[model samples]
Target: MEFSGKLFIFLLLPLLQISTCDAYANPIYHACSKNFTSDNLIQDSINKTLSSLLAKTSLDSFGISSFGDGFFTIFGLSQCRGNLTVDQCAPCITKATEEIRTLCPNSAETRIWYDHCFLHYGTTKFFGEPDTSFTRVFSSGLIAADPIKFNYELMDLVYRMNAMTVGIDEKFSMYATHVSKNLSIFATAQCTRDLEELACRQCLDKLSEIFSGSCKYHLDCYVLSSSCVLRYAVSEFLNLPVSLSPLVFAAGFLAAGINSNLTGGHGFLPRSKADVMLNQLPEKSGSPENRELTAGHLSTWPVIGGLNHFVLVKFISGGLTAG
Candidate 1:
């Protein structure tokens, strides 16, 4: 018994350490999976899981695969920095997906995003709005070496981007731009179209509270979340086309918040006509996919690129309000 206990701790300690340290080690990723364990004899679980995974996988760009039989669909995706070639995107996503899964196998659902790819899954209860569940928090981990300069720049950039982000859809939305700085400091904002602009704004407002004193500008740090993703990479995070005068892939048409319609509740609000013209589009880059804020309704996702010493109000519990 004593030997077993000792061995268990010896093994568990390293695993815990790895989980804490390995999270921010990557730069890009994509992750998606279904609910329920991969091996459930239950017929219903098998059917639903397979269907959801197939719906996404067979969908052109997301042509992923399931590991188990028709019942289980184990899938993960990623994109390289738009500047990177398809070859680079492959490795970035592959490595991140494998590593993230190893880190949180018990999570059922986990998404570890990086500058290169995104890895996600749906094994546990990650569907719908986690409100506090799928939300993400980021910090600088360092007190602005110069508080005054940091505060001035950070606040200015955040507000400027926010102001520019209003009214327009993601196509023209500009979140933050870092000029004459070490890194291009190009940051952008994205919100799932389902949330009313106000609701989306509120989510960002709450996320701001997590910054506490960390939002000090002047550094390479930013907050990114599902409902709203914000970044300040000190570099041009958005990439231009690789081919000659080729097209750019904007995040996609953001739904102009849902209006009850001119008929008081009859007609639908105007969305990206692109939503209707899916067939016309060739690639999956700008398809109308998902538009939910959090995975389970209120929770947040794990965060990357932040200062070491920071605090997060249990997901959505904090009295943070941009609303």
Candidate 2:
């Protein structure tokens, strides 16, 4: 999608969304095994593997390392968002290493996501592979005035980005365009650098399917997974040079009703224990009868500069959390 002329106007607004905050230390989501290692050798390998991966964060935005021999070997991978500078990426990874250790303690394998970076480690080799084992959906329940047209344009932007990311050396893409005079969208797609073209394509395709199905006409929506992430918002969430100004997007959006659903399956570690988060962040209620999250407790629209600026997020069936 080409840049829209009016799109430049929104760039002046201050970025207030939690997902786009500059402080990258805030944890977004994580998945870890309930099982902890009792062997000293295996625990040593995990520490070595994580330290090696953390060291590389200063050099580039992506790194993968394996430490130890035989079953004791620990494989680790770390990557910052595609647009981050070394200064921004390094500390995010550093904090992730510290936070994961504190949050999960001695789990054999774990994965953590911050706004600017992702870190994962396990005894098994998962490099160059696509994993959709766990999925989380965040949608702004605000429906578009013209749902059909908005979806057509949104898919166009997403598919074009997917094509570009897989074809490039850096498997990441972001863009912004005007859907209408009063409406604009900013989106991004990314895969771990360890993923080859085929693996990256596979991961992104799974995210696309979720976007096509559950995230149809919402003004803003994003699906997060272990291997890839697909997100689009009415406001600019990326770290582009331009600052978005507060604009009257649509009044009906502020009053939109919550639409929620539960898809049961806990990624790779489905039977793992209930997710352990810092400060015991609110999680989707674990009830067979109460399947939906009401706006009274779990749902909210955080206002920014007199505008309902943030996405309407739905916590899917997984250990999901927001910073």
Where is model 2 more than 4 Å wrong at Cα? 1-16, 19-23, 241-323
Computed on alpha carbons, the lDDT of every model, listed in order, comes to 0.35, 0.63
User: Where in model 1 is the C-alpha error above 4 Å?
Assistant: 1-101, 117-146, 163-185, 192-194, 239-323
TM-score of each: 0.44, 0.68
- Alpha carbon RMSD to native, model 1: 15.8
- List model 2 lDDT by residue over 83-161, tens digit each: 6667778999999988888887778788888878899898889998998876767677678999999998888777766
lDDT of 1 by residue, 255-294 (tens): 3221211110011101232233222322443323312221
Best-matching candidate per lDDT: 2
The lDDT, on a scale of 0 to 1, for candidate 2 is 0.63
lDDT of 1 at 46: 29
* Candidate with best TM-score: 2
